[model samples]
Target: MIRNDIRALDAYHVPDASGLIKLDAMENPYPLPDTLRRTLAERLANADIHRYPDAAMENLREKIAARHGLAPEQILLGNGSDEIIQMLMIAADQGACAAPAPSFVMYELIAKWIRRPFTAISLDEHFNLDADRFLQVVSREKASLAFLACPNNPTGNFWAADVVERIASDFGGLLVIDEAYAPFADRDHLHLINEHVLVLRTFSKIGWAGLRLGYAVGQASLISELNKVRLPYNINTLTQIAADVLLDHFHVFDEQATRIRCERERMQRALAAFPDLQTYPSQTNFITIRVPDAGQAFAHLLKKRILIKQLGGHALLENCLRITIGTPEQNDQVLEALKELFK
Candidate 1:
């Protein structure tokens, strides 16, 4: 039987996006080029699916490490960042877990599943983190693990680098600086990694989300410890093949990211014209806006066959809706719909 705590928790919900514009999730709006897709198909066809995946994934790790200027030994792969979060929760010392409230939900959700003590420090009214205050709470709770989602989701902003560095240096336990949105951000925390700090990244937002691949970089010893808890063959044969091949054509994804960044700025300007809405500055590929009525705005967009993330209920995110930057046409359609709704 499941524990009572597990029973009390609601399962994670993913809205059905069938036939809509499909912007509910922060996914890349572009698909692989025909040539690259065909190449991947041929490669996948030749894969030895009859055998298990390469458990070590040495080549893939090396490719990823080279992109970040690190060694393969310092890299650890996971099915997705979610699995790595679970692995960290299980492998780290047994004590309280800490993170900023209104950050990544997985950090708190995984902590709850394991019945570990969890503490969430609230962000200020402007969604800013006070480094000194955060460290004080971590010290008081004696938290053994912490996670920071750079350019945090739903809010779509990053804390100052100095603030993050101060906490990373002061905290005694393991600190995870999650850069899931780094591909779209102004900077990353990779240089902050040392004995007790790790940087997490995913290819999902840039592209290749279907492959479900994510990796972490840290001191070799820390990665070695986390590797023990990782399930064998966690990344399957198809994914391994696809990721290795895709990294070779990384320029395609890099160019696409540049396009998205440009589109994000254009969208920000368009959204600002709406007097009824307040838009937050974003370094990520999405924009979070506060509207007069998020529910009505969401429904209005749905009527126009668009799907977006409506982040309501949270105190800081009240009346807020998150829209992933899409192709120019897709973005135009959304802006038109919003203009109609507000008019």
Candidate 2:
């Protein structure tokens, strides 16, 4: 019953963390403050679980839009940004999708899941976009959607906004600027939002991953088109209530992001001092390092009960490992482990 293409592809895997420091996924390390947790419990107690979620989800949608300076009509909710990516692919039934090679795997993965032809244009050796060539190839391929993971995944570097907008405009298709890491970055491409550009966001990085809420902000018409393919009442009732209450206390996340940025810089400086470990510049909440032997370093860290993302196989990331910015204590532990391994 399954399509042959589906059988040929590997299922995306999440590493087990039964007993580890747990830094493989890019998650906020801090827990909700006791005060907030108590308040949240009180709020969650009020939700009507016996009924289906509000199909419109207008209140929650409005609050999210207000936070981003976008209109409610311009936003489309998803179980997470993952679902929105699927919706984009399902709606783009006519043409191909393109994204930078070794960026976000989901762009190509979801495209193929929907049987959409996909193209992955390679970034330069340092993992930056080669704008002219990327534009040329994507345009030639007649791609209907091009994904730009700003402060892109795995590599964690933001591409030049203007250059990407030009590339998308030239390709004559929708351009999704996946800003999953923008909360930690100093800059963003909101200045480039227009008819052809769509911005994707998720609460995952900001400590709301468990709630499974994400949104797309774009021109009203484009958002409407994507919505047609989205399942209604996708955001559950409890999640909607929790999101509203948490967003009302949005300053907590802002403070957490501030601390994470400081920790990221400190982590990078410490990683740079290690022998045979070169660190990449990052605007995201994680730091990616290239160790002399990623296999050895990864095994050593695993043995020490530290779990970080080992990105291998890609020629560009031959020895790379991405370490999420954890709490101060977690980072210190990782630093200590690196010191022992490097020695």
User: Could you say which candidate leads in TM-score?
Assistant: 1
lDDT of each: 0.93, 0.88
Per-candidate clash tally: 0, 0
lDDT by residue (274-298, candidate 1, tens digit) is 8899998898989999999999999
- Per-residue error for 133 in candidate 2, Å, reads 0.7
Candidate 2 residue 247 Cα shift, in angstroms, is: 0.2
Alpha-carbon error at 328 in model 1, in Å? Answer: 0.7
List TM-score per model, in order. Answer: 0.98, 0.97
**Candidate 1: pairs in clash:** none
Positional deviation of 323 in candidate 1, in angstroms? 0.7
* Residue range with the least summed lDDT across 10 consecutive positions in model 2: 162-171
For model 1, the local distance difference test gives 0.93
Per-residue alpha-carbon lDDT of model 2 for 1-343, expressed as tens digits?
Answer: 9999999998999989989998988999999999999999998998889899998877888888887788898899999899998998888637889898888888888987877899988888778898898888877898888898989898988777777767756767888888899899978777677888888999999899899989999888988888898898898988888898899899999999999999999998888888788888899989888988898889888999999999975799988999999999999999999999886
